[model samples]
Target: MPLLFIQRALMIAAVVSGLSACSLRSSPPSFTASGFVADQGVMRVWRIDDGQQRPLVLMSVYSPYSGPGTISTLYEYQNGVLYQIKRTDADGDRDSIQLRFTVNGTVSFMQRQLATQRQKLSNDDIALYQYQARRILEVSDALNVGRVRLLQGHWQQGEVKLCNGEVVKPGFDKQAENWIARRTTNNHQPVSLAWLDGPEGRELLLVANDDFCRWEPTKDTL
Candidate 1:
């Protein structure tokens, strides 16, 4: 499938991700907007707009949505600060993004993961990957966030310059855990990395990075 279509699918999935707490990780000891349980670990979910809740005990949480190489999101609070993180996977690649907001909803920090995955084909000795590079921006007075593409190319020829100005070369930094940007073409065009340790396991991070860098987007033909 075209990479664009897959990316669009992920973007849409993120918006709809704010599902009823009951549906995701369906049965947690506490699945409130303030916090929830995941795989025996407790992750505090802070409401971007307000703050109110009680201490939660750890419990087992069951995940209902399981799509290999799909997109998902997680919210957390630290030191009374609210943050949002999103993860997107494609083919065999996984990625994510983290956004920390102020009490009144001002963005304080942003970190995004730009990644690709290579999986060995059952019928062939070679492997292939699908790259889905996207942007997650702080919106609505930083009370919420939205996702859009910065650059996306698949196959072995995929390449993009992340929001941080780091370039994910066609096949640079290829490794088992994830791929990294080792080179840049600066093709008069630009685009978008990060890894995250989740409660269940480690997942790659996705979204925008307006914190460490300031590489803006430009129109380009893929």
Candidate 2:
């Protein structure tokens, strides 16, 4: 089956489970991390919510394994509704789009920057942005309920020091552990790992010698 269809099916199942859980529970986590594999690359998501389960912010980073540069998008919510969307590309072009919506979903502000030129987005472009924003929210909600989590940590000998400073053995499989060990051996430096945890299994997303914490967003930044 196509990936899109599979994703939608997962989202439907997750929504049902989430609703049932909500009836019996108070709320989901105030902060959560999740991700999904898209056709182009892997997309990691970070979400922050009010204690009551209303989302306050959602951010995603898309990193292609090859060919394309990374892109990041931030979605801010007010009163449980999307208020602003900001997207940036890390390529030489430096493409970016910013849109602010009114309470009624009207675009109150919109800006697009490509390279060094600033341009206005057409009506179709604005609509597409709105659609993408909603779609991402839906995907995020599904991943959260499906128990898919994104974890980041620094690798030490056979263990990982998580972003929160907790040191623990990661649940990665032997092959993944071997890969990390080999990369560390080759780099001669501390390596960082980002992986997705879910009911199905764990999948490695990134392995780099760079400091993952340096660019990671804190609650204050959101």
Q: What TM-score fits each model?
A: 0.24, 0.83
Q: What is the lDDT of every predicted structure here? A: 0.29, 0.77
lDDT of 1 by residue, 182-201 (tens): 22233223222222222223
Candidate 2 per-residue lDDT over residues 114-142, each given as its tens digit:
97799999998888777777777877776
Clashes of each: 13, 0
Cα-lDDT of candidate 2: 0.77
Q: Candidate 2 clashing pairs? A: none
Q: Which portions of model 2 show Cα errors greater than 4 Å?
A: 1-26
C-alpha root-mean-square deviation, each candidate: 19.3, 3.6
Stretch of 10 with least lDDT, candidate 1? 125-134
Error of 2 at 63 (Å): 1.1
